[model samples]
Target: MTKESDDNGNTPITGDEKTSVPADLLNIEKGDVVDISSDDALLMALGYKPELKREFSYLTVFGQSFGAMGIAPALAESLIFSLGSAGSVGLVWSYFLGCVALIPVALSLGELGSSMPTAGGLYYWVARLTPTRARALMCWLAGYMNVLGYISIFASTIYGATLILVAAIMIGSDGTWQTTKYINYGLYSATTILCFGMTCVPSGTLSKLNNTYIWFQLAMALAVIIALPAATPKEYINSASFVFKEFQNTGFWPNNGWAFMLSLLTPVWVVSGFESSATIAEEASNAARAVPFAMVSSLLIALVVGMGVVISIAFTMGSDVIAIVTSPLGQPMAQICLNSLGEKGAIAMLVFLWFTSICNCSMLLVAASRETFALARDGGLPFSSFFRVLTTNKTPARAVLFCALVTLAEGLLMLVNTIAINSIFNLAIMGLYFAYTMPLVSRLIFNEFKPGVWYLGPKLSYIFAVYSVVWMTFIFTLLLFPSYPNPDETQMNYAVAVLGFVLVFCLVYYYFPKYGGKTFFHGPVRTIDEVIATNLQLEEQLVRKMTEDRAASAT
Candidate 1:
């Protein structure tokens, strides 16, 4: 149909043309088809090439995801609430459980990521490991759920930042910063716009930016630990040691127990985003090595640094804990700051906390965009072709824009009511954890004995998978219950919201036929051989060029 010339002025077969180049000369199989397009030609057509740069090392990867401002500030609040109920001893136990639980889970994910370094991460793994008929459905559901989780994370960061900022401004100027409905809505819109703008940058530049944010988070965390303790009232430390005399009843929830249990969800919300690194496996240089490192390292760092901040604040504020927890600012840390450091020190702490929130929002935007792009590339979403388009810089610019718009809409929706914000936030947590655990559960249930270089040994791996599933399920169930209200008026409406979102997913799956939704799970899972074959093709081309260079030098 068409013809072209190679560099040596020889006729090049083009447009599905089959040339009889000698099998030995090309060393290609009989049925193998090699398309010869110059780099410039491909670049012109595709707009970008797959980046093979290995600029990021393991440590950088870990820092970018773990050091994100989003996870720490949220978790800090959760830790405070949990410690208030269980005391320091109970709080210590939870951290221990988290560490133990995460080890095996991290190991299993590490093996999977290393063996199959695709950008789609767990969903791709699921697609390969599960039954053919269910791959598309599972992937689509997982994508939707994960998106919700990330959106929640984004919103929470913005909300937290706004709270701290408003609190500091009010305290500094002798103005009362009450947490009212309208103020919260205004904060949500402003933070969302700021976060969206940060994400519009080219993806290549994002990693370096994230790295800087990580350092800032670390510095702020250190500052809080040092400054809060030094400025606190000495009597506050004595009061912290006094156990609760009685479980007080707040009209919102039945008793302090339920209140505390629901409150534990706050901490879980913060410590997440470890999986954010996994979503970028395709862009990562040597992803297998980097993804695992980042995931595990971030978790460990979050654990240590988060604990340090929580314990430091707890000991410093002591008796003021109750007041801080019930404060209108909705920031437990700010209360601690006010109690220990007085007004001036409190303002400083709030500034740092807000700064961390901004950093967290920026990182979340990047991770969410990557997940969106990865799903689209696998034909798991509507209008997959548009999402697959990349900019000249090789970033999924379309997907980034799409995620930004969705975030903006979600933020705007907050103006409707506090219930709307709470509903979305709760649903986000459930959806994210659901997406996170499902692929692991699917692997455990179906392909427990699948062979691979990354195998974690049959018995231990399955046990870890089972444990992860159980833990995640428990957390998801608890999340459904209202954290701040009694059973009668509990946010049962939020559960309805979750169901509505699910229905939307189903409708998209069943009705959208133009995007190959019908064929999502129609075929068998792609084998490791197929993956290797694609990789080898690229390798062979490199080898061929090297050989040609040698021959030219000799001549």
Candidate 2:
């Protein structure tokens, strides 16, 4: 484990603080006992009660995460934004490269989530992983970053989905339809309302919804993978030479290498949000095993499928890269589909993208609301009681509707200048990853990782955790770099400014008298005796089940 030293050169965290298990409790090694108390005991040890229903199985949780990333839909819509700096080789390679770099980051999250299954996720992990003196302050910052990140993710997704649908509308109109600013706003309103209503439904039905979307995503991606290439005309099909050797820098940037490097954001942005399962860990049964498995497996699935679709697009995107990106239809993917496939086939593809986007939007709303509800439950946000309230079926109904509405409201930025919308989307990658890297670094510093159902040995785990910090540092810098060089005021990247305001706002809010001054604002609260008692009851029930099983076998 890595260590930090003070000016005197002695380690700050002494021997007692090294182990995370409570000192008062017996030191029961994880996985050595059949106790029903592992997850709950860990939570109680960290001062939280297990209130969420543990109904989600491993596959169901994986389905939720797979739908959340919306990998195919995300790439289809965002590729146009990177066209100036990317060609066929650059486009497809960047995605797989980013996925490779992100594996360690995701695995780090898997390790942390397996050890601590909490709804607050990264922020909660930070609280438990850091030393006591710095715990509250660091946890507070991590929570704020996570909350703001998802809100931006929600807006960015809805906006992208809206554009895909709007492009379809224009296609069907045969040049008569125009996507006005208000039209974009209308689509955003409709999507927000639809997703909000769905998320507020009973928690049981939410699982069913995830199941449905998971299949839809697979079918749509498969259709595109086979159909698009088969339908492409011989003349329009790209050759191996063009696919692997071609290069384009039509955006007029100063450096082609840097421009290509920064264009990787398109893939990084699309492949992200795999951490959704970790955020929803509180709802999953045996989360220590399930959450990490769901996170790692979902990304692996997306990588294979997403790469296939990207390669297919690279092979069949047509000979005219310039025309496809600059299409008058106001949607690049829609135009590419039209040029590759005929009108009927193109319409069919757009319809597929539209529904997939809806599925993606729904998943994002579910995750964002749950995160918001968890934060509010811990008194991290305003009106904590209101946002934390669950419905008859244990769903965060109010938080779901409230956060969805706010994200839609932020979509009003589309009217000001469509280009600026990049800043909002960039916040999702920057905020979530920055938040993600913090806890991993903190864990290494404090030596806080404990063996769980899913264990990685210390040497290998520390290597990934430390590497993730370095990778995120580079990504953090690259995300803020201007997408278009020599930009006018309207074209400038505003993510740095907007993210700065958020950081300052978090600081101001933390220091405010009524908010952080209260008992709720303290890092994680201490577990009450009630939590331990409840675990004892649960343990008794497990014993009863085991006894019944043995008796039946004997009979």
Candidate 3:
């Protein structure tokens, strides 16, 4: 290979076959520079040069909102209440089953994350590992499902926070807690806005904020485990075992076992957001390892801590648990805290609960935006280009803003009626389960036999995958039914609202092709190498442009 300096004092390297510089040093000739090598072109394409960092602490990996005590206790109480009598046992069973099912899913995700760690997480994995024909649709659906999950999370957090606040006032004062329509709506709106505003902070700053939340959760967990138990009357502890063999209204023994099984879905919803850690893979240091560990660890902690607290509270309260859960006051956990700990202890618990809600909201915000960005990156949604743009800070600013707006809109819907709020909640849960089922089904039907970098050893993976699908499908069906016996028109209307949304989604999907529109899914798997190549090509282009400008200026 040989290269010579041009008249402008720039050297161009060439193969052994040829090339020379002009003799005149003052004169320069400019021409287009063409690189024949694909590798070289690819290196020129990728814009940013990200240096992988090792800044993540182990605590940071596992210490997120999913494990928070405030959220978990509220969630447990909600499930217990929704399940009623016979439903309580079923709810507990479902929770355990869900946790067990997560083991294989986590193992699979860990392997995938380890191999190709990206911020998009599962959708990114789908794009890289699935056939191209299916990539767009899979990505789009994943994005939708991810957003749904986050929205539900946001709503739940606000609901939990509001309950905590209400609990504080009621427990502190001698008067009954007032529950006016305007007051409830105002609380939801305020919390939603607060959470949305908090998300607008820079990513690095947000990370630090989340770390603070992790500590808050720890403290709250300790307070619940220690303070609440110590303050309760010994007599109150003995009252927990008085079982109601029949419902006063329904006269049904154990209050319908099937209904109880259905009620378990509420708890599943509460403990469900652990996957948010994986969704922020792009932002995390060493995400491949960190995301998976964070996800699985969060779940384990939620299980251990959540069940422990619930059981402790249950054993202490005895028969009062049912009365507390069924009360019109409507916030069982807060009621329990107040009943057991009095005013000061209740306030402490409320503060912790509030903090946990904020933490969970933060995680949801991040997860939702990432899903929107990931879908846009794959050209699977409208205004894809805008959504795909990353700010100088390397965060998806537009997507974040868009998600915030949607959250605000949903929050506003709460003012319409309780039915509307319930409807939205049910729809969100349905969307989440629908999303979860798709990937599991896709894996089972299409990629079951395909070996890749991450395999759960063929037989077991397939078996578990099958089990997951069945479990999800069963739960999905049951979730459509209302919990209360002989539900009022409002409850029926809520069910209709949820179903209506699904029908709309299906109809839209059906009509997309009628106008000669392209379907999101196309064929072929995209490897990690492909994404790297695309990024590198952009980088090389920038470098080449810089080099050419220098040469021209010298001339």
Off by over 4 Å in 1: 1-54, 69-71, 76-100, 176-180, 243-260, 448-455, 484-496, 511-516, 519-555
Using all chains and alpha carbons, the TM-scores for the candidates as numbered come to 0.78, 0.88, 0.76
Among all windows of 10 consecutive residues in model 3, the one with the lowest summed lDDT is 17-26
Candidate closest to the true structure, highest TM-score: 2
Better of 1 and 3 by lDDT: 1
Query: Tens digits of per-residue lDDT for model 2 on 1-555?
Result: 122335865233221221232322323445343333445545554566555666677877898788988877888878775664677766777888888888888888898888888888888889888887788778888887888788778778888888888888888888797878888888888988887887787756788888888999898889889998999888778887887777776455767788678768777788777888887787777788888888888889898999998888888887677787778887778887887887888888888998898888888887888788877877777787788888767788888877886787678778878777767778788888889888988888888767555667788888888998999888888888766667788887777777898898777788777655233577766534553454554434333433333343346
* lDDT, each prediction: 0.61, 0.76, 0.56
The number of residue pairs in model 1 that clash at the backbone is: 2
The digit string of per-residue lDDT tens for model 3 on 476-539 reads 6766766555666655536446445645663476347743114443322232344445454433
State the lDDT of candidate 1 residue by residue for 1-555, as single tens digits: 122236784242223432232232233468665432222122212222233223454555675577553544655444444544444433444554555566666666766665555556666666656676576677666766776677666765666667677778777876654556567667767777787777666555676777787878888788877877776667776434343232333225556555555545545666667767776665565465677777767777777887676666556656544565666656666666777788887787778777777878777776777777767665655686797677765667677777766766666545655455556555666877787787787787687434333456778878877877787787778777654444344335364465466758655665578643564533223322332244544434433433343344346
Report backbone clashes per prediction.
2, 0, 35
RMSD of each: 8.8, 8.6, 9.9
Q: Candidate 3: global Cα-lDDT?
A: 0.56
lDDT of 2: 0.76
